[model samples]
Target: MSRGHRLALAILLLTAATAPVGTAPVTANAGDGALVTAVPNPTADGDAGEYAVVRVPTASTANWTLDDGERVVAVPTDRPAARVALTATPNATRRLTDVPVVAVPALALSNAGERLRLRRNGAAAAALTYRDAPEGDRLVRTDDGTAWRPLGYQPRDVHRYGPATVTGFVLPDSPSLPVETLRSARRRLLLAGYTLTSSRVVDALIAAHRRGVAVRVLVDAEPVGGRTARGAAALDRLAAAGVDVRALGGPRARFDYHHPKYAVVDDRALVLTENWKPAGVGGRSSRGWGVVVDSAPVAADLAALFRADAGWRDALPWRRFRRGKTFAPGASAEGSYPSRFEPTETTAAGVRVLTAPGNAESALVGVIDGADDRVDVIQPTVGRRDGPLLRATIRAAERGVRVRILVSGAWYVAEENAALVEWLNGLAERRDLPLTARVAEPAGRYEKIHAKGVVADGVVVVGSLNWNENAVSENREVALAVRSDALAAYFRETFVADWQGRGRVGRTTWVVVAGALAALVLAVVVARKTIRFA
Candidate 1:
């Protein structure tokens, strides 16, 4: 059977739903933020046990109750239902008896479908309903109660249109502002990105920290560093406010730059193509795509990733930015081009994640290899001619597939992409391939195309992975490869608008003409030199 056929069968089997796996707990990051992590019971000699950890951020004299749909699991009799602190408790595992409760019903939770709810002063604070959970694993909220994900302990098969839903964002077109959505971070917030000078986003993190929320930020150290860099200044400001801010790539750094643009708020993960800078997400700046995913597994995986990067280790040593470091001002957007298109969204399934300093290139290559028809790509720029991804695109075109690449036409991007366009056209002609490439016109409101995405044969891959070797091999990156024609079509629509600007010569056609003129000039120079020698 075809891949699609097999995927459909798998989803069908999941819908049948056997006796639900061990009760999957629902934990929300907002409201009275709750955490349900699986830890080894010290009393049980390292065997696993579920700990219902709750955080009441406010000072309250009211009681809170934990219910598993049927009966009251545990109720705290003391004032201030749970720990209300800015930091996580030292040890998360607690026995049922440890809870300061008035009474406890059957302590052992049901393994089948159960609606776990948390109520504060008789008001619903947060709740999670789960079914068919894997054994020995714990479910936690990546955002509010709306999204839940299992901690990513091992690789999982892609679920076809699984329970996960993907919400997309195109800058300046999103219904609500990105910063507005970010302000909802209630429990713990983790942010990782290359550049972050946006006052709105930075202020949000600072405010969340002051409000006693656990907030941590990790950013690239080099380009965004120095006493003059705006990003550095922002980091310093956040650090001063008691927010744990670390710079990736110290002297003994593993990656060139920590370039993943994402934020994990509660149980939700916001993956974006734009940075947290003004020119990135500002309504009338660069054109890009952002994806909001509420999957417990994905959120847990990203959270684990953030911890690993933020923690001090021998291999990837991180340096925390100290206060008083003079930081440069933010970038100026004096000559930004107008955006031609607006933001749009589409749902997708079978989403495969790719992380860098890992096997991101291989995963992307695998997707490209699967394309049988057309492939459309949009990126800020392509760095190397012989990069694995670039070569793969060329090879795909050699196989008679129509391949078109669109890169930004902004001043910073135009130079690099010019050489790339010329190189791709040359290869296509020499190999007689059906490959074409273009640089987006800076005519519209969209000054640049910062999005790094691909649409190929009923699949859509979008996120912060740039079209460069450093991004693939040396920098931290996150990408989502989705298997859905609806998503693919949405991207293809943007690619077409960018590829066809007002009265412009095709990249391949113009490159051919430019090549001919250059060749003629070189031939004349050679003839003159030969005559002089004679």
Candidate 2:
């Protein structure tokens, strides 16, 4: 069957209106249990496809249930999943009226208006519901049919706390779903409808704020010496437009926000990228691709990290640096972090935040040395590098780190980098490095890999730009060093697909010779034209 048909089959399986296990009582996450995510309620039945599947954190080995009405289907057992499809019948109100959320010591999710409050016996619990819907479906346990919370009763300033969760998305150029697919991707996200933005994206938060969508953005505040005057102008525009724009510190500070291209919409969809320009660069453009998830725990944790980092609060419109207060972007809910690197400890998971005085390059080297199980790397510009990052990667591959790299760019910037790229390949071929491919082979400039990410042993380092020191040391950088398995696993799968693409760019052909001849003829014609003009 076609891929589209297969995808349809999967959804059909999720919504097949069948009851689950006929056994007696089965338990899930204990206590004032569970936090999750979901889409805004559909305005009517026309909003059917617009629903979001939600999966709360439970046993990795435990099966899940999505009880819309009499239809009970089993959601796959995983750390973060969105397999639960909520079928909203008309007048079937899905609110945060009932759902148990742990205290600040655990995780919580908030709506656009306020924190998600779980009401037990009409009393508000301290832990906010991690996933609460204003429109569509909210939390209702299949075990007891209890609605645990009331909607919009939680405070607006209930700071989000817990260890950082990350969603690592490397925009791959699927031949069928090319870069232009970004427009469709943006449309898909917009169609899902979020309370976080007015338009899906592209207008920045000014438009979102006006739409009553909570608008928050983090931009790199660092100077790129003389390289690209990109971030400054964009942030300026956003700030002037009445958006909540903040600048993370430049290369000089201790906790600067270096990578600034990623923004998570409504904590359900994320755009992780290096091409932060509202447009592309130097005659060449960019291709963007990513996944929209149903897991709110994953979304909430990531959004929390973006807020806690001090780099975002120092500059631009939300210039809180002068106020001397902590850089708390939103009120802390439950699972929140102090920065991208710090862990607030939510779901029994641990996190590590690798600082980048050296920027992404430093982070890359750290990963090479840190991996115990799997190592996956993604790059838009894995350009020429003589430094520690390159050496560390090679060493890790040699030592059995299961090193797999997806270089999105062609390493075509400098002749030197292309040569180095050749050397790295030669080494991998010679068994000097145990590397595999994840992205489609460099498909010229038309399609390139633009994600700079590394995930190892349930840890993820994702951010703006690529796998080159040019970005970390000289350019402005910002990223999250994630410590959640949910985020890390997502990075791993996306990395695998990208690596497969890289593997497909097989042996070079004589097309190079033909291309060279063509270039020579064109150059001659141009030269002759210039002479005639003179």
On TM-score, the candidate that comes out on top is 1
- How well is each residue in 186-288 modelled by candidate 2, as lDDT tens digits? 2112111001111214353445555666566654443333213233344445556766655545322223234544445554434344343322211133433
Please identify model 2 stretches exceeding 4 Å from their true place.
1-204, 211-241, 244-258, 264-271, 276-348, 351-355, 358-364, 383-386, 409-417, 429-432, 436-446, 474-476, 483-490, 502-534
TM-score to true structure, per model: 0.61, 0.42
Model 2 clashing-pair count: 43
lDDT of 1 at 510: 82
Model 2 per-residue lDDT at 316: 39
Please provide, for model 1 over 21-41, each residue's C-alpha lDDT reduced to its tens digit, 9 standing for 90 to 100.
333332335345453332112
lDDT against true structure, model 1? 0.62
**In order, what lDDT does every prediction score?**
0.62, 0.40
All candidates: CA RMSD in angstroms? Answer: 15.3, 21.1
